[model samples]
Target: MSEPTRRPPSGAATLRADKTAAIAEAVLDELAEHGYGRLSMEAVAKRAGVGKSALYRRWPSKQRMVIAVVSEPTVALADPPDTGSLRGDVLAALHAVADWLTHPRFSRILPDLIAEAQRDDELRRALALRIGEPRRARMIGVLDRAVERGELPPDLDRELALDLLGGLVYWRVSARGAALEPGYFERAADMALRALDARPRRA
Candidate 1:
């Protein structure tokens, strides 16, 4: 059975929650402007029209606040139309990813976040848990369905498939200093499918 829903908090608690959300939004804006390492708590407080103590009361540190900023359910998978073919679904999902990654607003934060992940272990963990894991799971689900439909090998490693797909985008966005490019996702998906089909026979 599903778990029961918890009761909503009182009016004051609700107000505090709203204030916290406002602070988080302000912090996101600041990160967009200044990037992660240079983000200032005092600046966020001023932009949020709250005192630094208020932010500190809610989140102990800048890392914690950044985690909170990204901890929302902003990313999700699009339901495949299942045109009786895995290729179409995979292509569709890839296109969706390309569109998401290419958008100037969303794409700007990624390089920053990834760079931050290199040094701050706590932020890295939180980003992987909150943002990375769910998106990876969605891609894995797409690959799993392809396997079920016999479009790809059943023994294919889902994690590796995700790495391949993500690596293609990461290389362009983070490493090559290029913006999201057209046809990149389709090419990645094609290569991923080929790899899935080319698994060597077990001894």
Candidate 2:
């Protein structure tokens, strides 16, 4: 006698990872093109080549779908590498922020999401919870290590540090539309270090 394998009562979402990934990407494209205020489940389904029902099965609403999909790349880039020294760590953080801000469709999608959230209180809160908080918490790890290494003051303003860490880069790329030139990463890292009053590691 053989035993039958039990499956999810809702069916095999786990088996449709590729389809889910495609849908997520489709959502990004739609967001970049139409903005969150204009995005529709049908548009995403058409772009993804999946039925509208497929989306509903995964998410109860458009906002839920957007947050879940957008949060993937946002959260994935949270943890910067431990480069030992505060300068190295700051440089790493700058690089990570740059990477996320300039990501293909996400670069455009993010700005749209931000614009839409500005007018919608609920959307803003959802973004903060699903995307902002997780990313902020991960970024705090970099400053925490600097504090432990005695490179930063014990009373370091970590939230402020996080702001200054990615602020300039975000402004330049996401707002000012400036290209990242050679040495820009180092310059940004140095500026953040200055802002944080970081003590450089002794050579």
Per-residue lDDT over 39-124 for candidate 1, one digit per residue giving the tens place of the 0 to 100 score: 89989999989889888876678887776565452354333346545666666766655554554544556678888889978788
Off by over 4 Å in 2: 1-15
Residues 157-192 of candidate 2: C-alpha lDDT, one tens digit per residue: 888888887688889999999999998987887778
Candidate number achieving the greatest lDDT relative to the actual structure: 2
**lDDT of residue 143 for candidate 2:** 82
Which lDDT values do the candidates have, in the order given? 0.67, 0.81
Spell out the clash pairs found in candidate 2: none
lDDT of candidate model 2 versus the reference? 0.81
lDDT of 1 at 103: 49
lDDT of 1 at 191: 79
